[model samples]
Target: MAGRIPHPTLKGPSVVKEIVIGMALGLVAGGFWKMYNWNEQRNVRAFYDMLEKGETSVFAEEKDRGPD
Candidate 1:
């Protein structure tokens, strides 16, 4: 099987396309990471606020259950 396999030549336009695609992917990933970090920070802040307010059980359910 010594047949010459034809491969598409990677040239200037293809290189530019690759760069643009890579940048787009990076931006999307960065946005997701930012959102995750923001959510984590928000949860931490809420926990601290609960502690500041003297919550005995930080993870306890609210005692306002209406019925069993």
Candidate 2:
């Protein structure tokens, strides 16, 4: 009896293409995450700076002032 043909391979350029696509997708996701969290990061940094500068009453004053 005749032997059956082998399955198609998926190495070389095909693998490289998949890797590139995956990396591009990862970069896009990371960019979106950074963009979404930009404001939160900025606020955290601002709070840290205020604490460093000894502005301990800023949050209390804001609470007393209520909503803008």
TM-score for candidate 2, please give it: 0.44
Candidate 1 stretches with Cα past 4 Å from truth are: 1-13, 56-68
lDDT of each: 0.88, 0.85
Each candidate: RMSD to true structure?
A: 6.6, 6.7
Model 2 clashes, total count: 0
Model 2 CA deviation exceeding 4 Å by range? 1-13, 43-68
Q: For model 2, give the 10-residue run with minimal summed lDDT.
A: 56-65
Please, what are the lDDT tens digits per residue for candidate 1 over residues 1-68? 69999998865557778999999999999999999999999999998888888874557676887878
